[model samples]
Target: MKRTQARFDVVGQLGALRRYARSLTRDSSDAEDLVQDALLRACENRSSFEAGREVRPWLLSILHNVFVDKTRRSKSESLRIKGLAEMSPKQLDAPQDHSVRLAQIRAAFMKLPEEQRTALHLVTIEGLSYQEAADTLAIPVGTLMSRISRGREALRSFEQGRDQTSLKLVGGRDVS
Candidate 1:
């Protein structure tokens, strides 16, 4: 497939793509594959994101579709392309002191349904507006709002269940 070089910088969206992919797949390695596939598809399908539209949500929408398609294919075939999962970033763990807390939050975050996780990531982590996220997901704005609401409530519940006398969550730049 030929990629007409995008006028906007595609590389600039890498972090958000990776972050959203991680939230979707819940595995950094598979997340990388998802991002790669999405980027490839994005490059191949320039019409997917029209000029003047928010590229981040469009890229994310592509990533989300790729993940959904793969999940469906794997389920039907009864086999996942394990090779993709192995395409890890070779990232080392952060310090235990910080990693532990972040991991806990991540674990809790990951526990949410894929739809909820996706909505939360798009709005909160990626800083997309509700309408933008809704459009990206191809869902109604009301549905997006509901997902974000439920997702936030679940995270709040997760917080309440945790020990109250613990240090606050570590807000590290690295999502993976």
Candidate 2:
């Protein structure tokens, strides 16, 4: 691909890449950093990319790998204290009712296992097809389907206040 076209292709996928990064990182600043790192790596390895293939999935895969690497490296870092030290006290204010539901959903989403969360985010939130999402995660399409199913089930259980672990096997056979 021509240099100009290559640059344009990478730039065109920036929004999707940023959204996926935000879903993965769950923090704006960290998402930005992840996007930047992925872009840099993509540009550096541009020649390795096939000319006619879609770029979004490639960029997302790079972002996922970058996040995994960062997580592994940060595992050895010392814990940092978190507090409201940087915030200035303000007068008490009422919370927005609409935001409360969204917050609860977001909290529930954050509680899901990383694999399931990634599958759900890629397919439901990012609007990727099953094959595309599977390719991005380097998993089989069937595996992706299973993860998405489990993730949705877990979210539904949370909404309905059901205990997923309460079911017991019957006659040495599994029962869900």
Q: State each candidate's clash count.
A: 0, 0
Task: State the lDDT at 44 in candidate 1.
Answer: 95
User: Tens-digit lDDT track for model 1 on 1-176?
Assistant: 23334645689899999999999999999999999999999889976666667788888889999999999988866544455456755675667878788898998888777888899999999999999999999999999998888778778877788432322322424232
* Top candidate when judged by lDDT against the true structure: 1
lDDT of 2 by residue, 1-176 (tens): 47647644777888998899999999999999999999998889887777677778888898899999899777644232123533545555556766897898898888777888999999999999999999999999999998888888888997898745432212345445
What TM-score goes with each of the models? 0.41, 0.41
**lDDT of the structure predicted as candidate 2:** 0.82
Report how far residue 117 has shifted in candidate 1, in Å. Answer: 75
**lDDT score for residue 109 of model 1:** 83
What is the alpha-carbon lDDT for the whole of candidate 1? 0.82
